[model samples]
Target: MKKSITALGLMSGTSLDGIDLALCSFNNKKSGWSFRIEASETVPYSAEWKRKLREAENSSARDILLLHNEYARYTGEVINRFLNGKTKPGLIASHGHTIFHQPQKHFTFQLGNGTFIAAETGIKTIADFRNMDVALGGQGAPLVPIGDRLLFSKYDYCLNLGGFSNISYEEDGQRIAFDVDPANIVLNYLAQQVGKEYDRDSLIAQSGKVDDTLLKELNDLPFYNEKPPKSLGKEWLDSELVPMLKKSSLPLPDQMRTLYEHIAIQIGEVIHNSGTMLVTGGGAHNPLLMERITACSKAEVIIPENKIIDFKEALIFAFLGVLANQRQINCLAAVTGASRDNTGGTIHLS
Candidate 1:
């Protein structure tokens, strides 16, 4: 195994917030795995690019294929700009923009072609981190648990509040993880309805009151009752969740407030009566959401420094690249319900 590795991780989440780039270094020592975020930034997507990506899911096959390469080239260009006068990484691992994720159908797709990224960046690249797991009957999600187990063992639970809220933790000597519920995806959509990008500090939600009827309806959704090894995607949100919210006919602020309560309840159920829970991701910055989660779960929630809150997922993706490069187990079968633990990611050598 390599003693040390520096890699750049790129992540484009479902919220269409931006592309997160984390340049991280990993060191393998006798104690365990240690890491440092040498540099990190989130390059927000332009209106045109956001529209293209948002509409890509419904586009014709030819158009989707074209956008895939176009997005990859664009990503490479962004990396080039980000790395200007910075340390050039040994590897680049991209989670890509998730366009279609349907593990139940035994397939998933993330845009941004690895070959194009490698070609444009002139560096070893790793992408397509989920297809193999889906092929093995896995959800192809919550991929950061392995990092939680190895790199963040000190925390009892690691909850990431990105486009969606997912939790990872050790249980019975195995890493268990799954999507909890919607987060920024739903919130951002509602915010956009009012000409805002997102509910800053969850102010919109805090200003409104939770409708018990809506909250109850959301809480009773069958997805929440499902067991672990399950996941969610844009399709599910569009088909199941979005319609429900629309049918309620409540005011937008009430919808946002009720949704926050619903999310807190679902997460509370998962981490009920637990130890310390480390919260990260963009949602961690939302004071109201954090307060609701704290009130519901009764778990001591610890929000780390700003860097970790915003870039932990990207940092872990870089770690995933390091493990994949070494042919070590990066995706856990226990967490993803794959046929077996496997090294996930396709290497595109430059």
Candidate 2:
């Protein structure tokens, strides 16, 4: 029998939609791992859970710590049931829920207890993959680029339309990635104003014309002017975007329209013309937004297999965990502007 490597990669994206659990089998050489996604599901968060996570940043330190262990145990329980006690994975690689991320302050927090997970599940785990980079003066972000570089290198670029629009591409042998702009985050916020979670196929956006004033202001935000190795967070949106949009008093459709275009321009500027970009994530389902991106950049947008669209982040985080398990360099200096290219992640045993 061949040696088998089974991994369960967990991701809780910015959308706050739910937890994406991906089980995959890796059986091959270091550069030639063949993976078949065993089973996957998006366990939607309850209304109460969503509310707590959405307001978690402003909550007390004690509550955040409590939630940290709570989430960790919840994750372990989920994994246990997913396995059904039938099989045990070689590794549990978690991209734990991000609660606080402020690289400038040299502090970042992702709340899921790997140690607690190991203790509870009696399974080896690796997690908290972002803090060390920040401690070393790095953005501790876009860690998926390492996975992009290794697993999906054939494409010129990989753009994920998750809660936020982010792109990762190779340039002269170095990989680059950053939050392009708000994707579902802004659009969904506008959608909620009209009692919708998201605009299916970007119908609301297609129904309205772009507000030039709003579009121009969004394009000129100081964050856009920053070169690279930068990222966005809920805090920035709360402080900058929400207030600006609320004060604009523009119709919701116009806000969605302008925000969609803003995301297009933000992403379009980074990818080269005519380059093939493998686009994925829930936002890839947005036809109007994809149409705008194609219009803005004139690039070839390719959506791969449905599984890839829905679970690529979870898959790539699995790859990141594998690299970290091997004690290899998984975060790049060029990408996150870290002081050094570092092997990041902590491991916990049963």
Candidate 3:
């Protein structure tokens, strides 16, 4: 490895909050390695792009392709603006926005085009991190556990409270991970009803009553009954969750409250909820929801520094790109249900 390398980590999660760009420097010293985040920013999405992304689940195939190309260009512009032509990084690692994630069908799509990123940025790019795993009969979702195991193993377990909730932990010394429940995705939908971006700190949940019936229905969803190596996307939310949420006559607050409990319960059971649980992601900002999970589980929810809590996945995706460059395994067998641990991702040379 070079004495040091700079990485521009980019992420746009399901929360639809914005794109997070982290300029990180990694140094390998005699004592292993350490990373220092130098500059970072959350680039809010334009309203047009936001609507298109949220409504992309049912978009026409032609439109999906069009958006895929457009989004990749948009991503490149964002990265350039963030860097201001400063030090050029060795490469770019983008967890392109997930457009369709259905591993059961043996397919997944993260739309931002790697070729476009490479052409626009004139640097090597790595993307499409999940499809190869799905092709290998693995759950293409929850790909971050590879990074969780390699980069943040100090914690007994790591849970990302992102657009959806997922956990990464060691089982029998092998990394195991999967989606726990829908987090900000459902919560933010309800929050939008109240004319806000999200339930700021999940205060709305604290103000509402938990509808037990709705909670029961949510917890009983077939996805929860299924085993790991499973994942959920907006399509699942629209097909399964939206109908369930719509069938209930409950008001927005009650809906949010019940959904909150569902997330808490599913997440609690997935992880023992014990030991140092390194929780990060946009949903980590949801205090009331976190409090409820804490009340239900005997786990120490450790919210790391804001940069990590917000952009850890972006950072890890960048790290995954590095591992790919080194021909190291970036996909864990136990985590993805693959036949073996594999290095999965497409690399684009400048």
Q: Pick the candidate with the highest TM-score.
A: 1
Q: Could you estimate the TM-score for every candidate?
A: 0.98, 0.96, 0.95
lDDT of 3 by residue, 1-350 (tens): 56677877788898888888887777756765577777788999988989989888789999999999999999999988888957888988888888778777878888799999989989899888887788888887677987786678799889899888888888877777888888988888888888988888667877779888888888889989888777788889989999988778888888998888888888888766468888898877777788877776667878899989988888887787777877888888787887777888899887
Candidate 2 per-residue C-alpha lDDT over 283-334 given as tens digits, one digit per residue, 9 for 90 to 100: 8888988888888875688989888898888887777777788888889988
Global lDDT scores for all candidate models: 0.93, 0.85, 0.83
Residue-level lDDT for 72 in candidate 3: 94
* C-alpha RMSD of each candidate structure in angstroms: 1.1, 1.6, 1.7
Clashing pairs in 1: none
Candidate 2: 10-residue stretch with minimal lDDT: 26-35
Selected candidate, larger lDDT, 2 vs 3: 2
Candidate number with the higher lDDT (1 or 2): 1
Give the clash count for model 1: 0
TM-score of 1: 0.98
